[model samples]
Target: MISAGIDIGSITSKVVILDDGRIYGSKIGFTGYNAERAGSSIYNSLIEELGIKHENVNSIVATGYGRNSVQFADKTYTEILCHAAGAFYNNSDIRTIIDIGGQDSKVISLSADGNVKDFCMNDKCAAGTGRFLEVIARALEIDLENFARLSLQSGKPASISTTCTVFAESEVISLIAKGESRENIIAGIHDSVASRLSSMVYRVGLNPPVMMTGGVAKNSGLVKAIENRLGTGVLVPESAQINGALGAALLAAKQNYRQ
Candidate 1:
């Protein structure tokens, strides 16, 4: 069966096509004006790229903060469930999952048999999320894709004490004017972001062999900082951001095939 998943996220939307239980194709795009437009665009991309006729797709499911906005999806699910489901689908041995998205972060604990046992999320703040980094990068007149590259070149990261996003942005600007190197500033941002995220994981107590998901997982510098804080390595998937959509697609396939 050709089942599909569409995840309309706050910052981006993703689509996945699954044939039976295996993913056939997937697409990702930044969210435009509205969630509906984002979902439609991603859906069209997968259909064209995979050369799959629209009606040939058996089922569709949506997930993420904007899941309910996907009018085309047959069902909607929370990003929390979708992330855990996707992680289990990819690697059943996964003990914990860390999903750092544009505006929030979550740490999920799973049983040995691939079920969610516990989870913790930092949703109200931008201090430790991808959106935080993006704002800092914008202030620095640097590209989001280049934040890590510049940060990794620093000799030492400057200290940022505030957890409030507004206060932190002001602190970054003050540091920049105080003869701090661009590299140092960027590194400091990463440290601050990682510090905020580590607090959540510490509070939740995830087991080892943790997998990193969501858009921020693509950031190598943040991943390294998180590892440093936790004293353990994190597994990052190549398709990190799309895992929620993949899970939604998998669930859709199961439902459709069973029916």
Candidate 2:
């Protein structure tokens, strides 16, 4: 059976195709301002690229912030459940998940069987999220892609005490005015983000064998900061950015088999 999963996040959309329980193909694209269009466009593009006919897809599951916007989805699942399933699928030993997306951050504790035991989300603000980093990057006049490399070069990360994104940006600007090294400032930003996220992780009761699944998982500097803050190593899967889509596709296949 062929099944598809679409995850329409705030900043990007992803689609994953599964052929009889194995990954067939995946695609990612900017979500822009239209969630529904982004979801359909990415899914259709992936299907076409794989030379698969629409009718041949047995099931489709949608997930993420715009899960309900995918009209073609056979069903929708919450990001929490999808992230947990995706992490477990990647590494069964994973007992905790830290997903830092474009607009929000979440910490999920998984049961021994890969079920979500508890979760904590910071959806009310942009602080400690990818967007927050974007703001800081802009203030630093540095490309977001270079953040990790620069952060690693810092001898001593500057201190950023603000938890608010706006204030953080101002603080970064002030540091720049004070002739602070870009690398130090960037490292400090990573530490600030890690500090905020670690609080949520602690609140949800941290467990060992943690996995981080989200677009920000690609940020090696932030990952290192989080690892240092938690005093443990964190795993990042190759499909970290598309873990939610993979989970949705897996769910689609399972549901189709049951039916």
Candidate 3:
């Protein structure tokens, strides 16, 4: 059976198509101002790219911040559950998941069977999130794509003691005025984010075989910082950004089977 999953995140929308349990392909695009339209657009684009008719999809699931906006989905699931399922599908050995998206960051602990045992989410603020990094990158006049690489070149990361994004931006400006190296300032920004996320990781209790899933997982500097703070390696899947959609697709397949 062919099933699909749509994940409508704050900054982007992703659609993944599965033929039975195997992936057909996935598509991603900016969410834009119309969330519902974004969901349908991505799904339609994916199906078209796969050369599959809409009728061929047996089931559909929606997930992420805009899950409910997907009226076409057969059902919707929370990102926490979807992320756990996706992480397990990628690596069954993974017992912990750290997902940092556009606006929020979460740490999830999974049971032996890949079920979510507990989760801690920071949704109230933009600090320690992708948005925070975006702001910092803009303030530093650096492209977001080059931010991580530049950070890695630093010999001494400047100290950024604040967790608040606004204050952090101001701090970065002050650092620039003080003639700090761009590399050092960028590294310090990553370090601050890691410090905040590591606290959540510890709060949820460290489980071995951790996997990070989300758009921010692509940031090598942040990954390194987190690994250093946790003193453990973190696995990042190739489709890290769409893990939630992938999980939703897997769950949709199961749901179809149950019926």
Candidate 4:
């Protein structure tokens, strides 16, 4: 059966098609202002790119912050469940999932059978999130792509004490005025993010074979910082950005088979 998953995140929308539990194709695009539109656009684009007819898709599941916006989806699932499933599908041994998305961060503990045991989320503030990093990157006048790389160059990361994003930005500006190196400031930002997330990780109980998903997983510096704080290695899947979509697609396939 052909199944599709749509993830409408705050910053981006992703669509993945699966054929018999295998990835057929996937696409990603900015979410823009209209989440519903973004979801349809991405899905449409993917099918067109893959030369698949819309009717050929047997089941569809939507996920992410704007998941409910996909009116055409057969059903919607929480990102927590989706991420857990995605991680397990990638590697059954993964017992933990750290998802740092554009606007939120979450740590999920999973059972060996791929069920979600417990999960904690940081959604109240931009701190420890990609948005926080974006603010810091802007203050340092560096592109987001270079933000992580520059942090790795720092001999010593500066200390950012605040968990508030606005306060942290102010602190970053102060550091810049004090002649602090950009690399140090960047590294400090990563450290601050890691520190904030580390608490959540422990709150859910750190489990081995941790998998890091979401947009921030692509940030090597943040991954290293988190690894340092946790004293363990974190795994990043090849399709980390669309892990939720993949999971949703898998769910779609399962639901389709049950019917």
Candidate 5:
């Protein structure tokens, strides 16, 4: 059977195609302005990369923040369920999952048998997320890519007091004016992010091996900062960006079971 998974997140969209029992293709792209454009991009990827006809795809499960807006998805699943399933599929050893996305953050706990036991999500505030860091990066006159790279150079992270993104922008600008090195400011930002993230993990009583998913996981500096705060190395999946899509695809693959 052929199935597809489409995850339309706040920052990006993920598409996954499953043929038989294996992944046929998985693609990632920006969410753009709406889920329709994102879903069409996913479908285009399925056709161009996987050589699957529209009729071949039996089910398409939509997931993530914009799950409700996926017109083409036959069904929709919450990002919480999708993240847990995806993390389990990638590494069953993971007892805890931390996903830091563009606009929100979540920490999920899973049972040994692959069930979501508990989860805490921070969706209301952009304070401790990728968007917050992006704002800080822009204010510091550095691109996000450089922001990620420069953070690792810090011998010790400096302090960034403001928790709110709008205020943090002003703080970053003031730091720059005071002749603080951008690298230190970048390091400070990572430290701040890690502290906010660790707070969530602490709430769940972290269990290892911990897994970090979402676009923010792509930031090596952030990963290092989080690891330092947690006092352990974290596992990051090879296809970290598309875990939601992979989970959706896997869920679709299990549409039926034979007696």
Candidate 6:
């Protein structure tokens, strides 16, 4: 059976197609101002690219921040559940998940069977989120792609004491005015994000074999900072950015089978 999953996030939309139990194709695109449009566009793009007609798909599941926006979905699941499923699909050994999205961050504790045991989310604030990093990157006049490389070069990461995104941006600006090294400031930003995320991880209960999902998983500097704070290695799957969509696709296949 062929199944599809769409994850409409604040920053981007992703679509994954599963042929039977294995990945067939995937697509990613900016969500822009309309989640609904983004969802339809990305899904259609993927199906078209794969030369698969929509009618041939057996099931569809939507997830992430704009799950409800996918009017074409056969069903919808919360990102927490989907992320757990995705992590487990990647590695069943993963007992903890840290997903840092554009507008929010969350930590999910998973059972041995890949079920979500408990989860904590930071949605009321942008601190420690992808958007927080974006703001700092803009203030630093540095490309987001270079953040990880430059941060790794820092011998002494500068101090950024605030957890508030606005306050933190101002603090970064102040540091820039003070002629602080870019690498130090960038590393400090990653450290601050790690500090906030580590607290959330601890709150949800830290379990070994942690896996990080979402677009921020690509940030090696942030991952290293989190590892240092947690004192444990973190795993990043190759499909980290599309994990939620992958989970949704897996669930979609299961749903089809149950029918």
Provide the RMSD of all predictions against the true structure, rounded to 1 decimal.
Answer: 1.5, 1.2, 1.2, 1.2, 2.1, 1.2
Q: How close is every model to the real structure, measured as TM-score?
A: 0.95, 0.98, 0.98, 0.98, 0.95, 0.98
Q: Judging by lDDT against the true structure, name the best candidate.
A: 6
The candidate, 2 or 5, that scores higher on TM-score is 2
Clashes of each: 0, 0, 0, 0, 0, 0
Candidate 6 wrongly placed segments (more than 4 Å): 257-259
Give the alpha carbon lDDT tens digit for every residue of 1-259 in model 2.
9999899999989999999988999999999999999999999989999999998899999999999999989999998988888889899999999999999899999999989999999968999898999999888888889999999999999999988999989999999999999999999999999999899999998899999999999999999999999999999999999999999998898877323
* Candidate 5 wrong stretches, greater than 4 Å: 256-259
Off by over 4 Å in 4: 257-259
Q: Which pairs, if any, clash in model 3? A: none
Q: Give me the displacement of residue 248 in model 1, in angstroms.
A: 1.1
Model 3 quality (TM-score)? 0.98
Please give the lDDT score at residue 129 for candidate 4.
88
**Model 6 TM-score, all chains together:** 0.98
- Per residue, candidate 6 scores C-alpha lDDT tens digits across 1-259 of 9999899999999999999979999999999999999999999989999999988899999999899989989999999988898899999999999999989899999999999999999969999999999999999999889999999999999999998999999999999999999999999999999999999999999999999999999999999999999999999999999999999999999977324
What lDDT would candidate 2 get against the real structure? 0.93
- Model 3 steric clash total: 0
TM-score of 4: 0.98
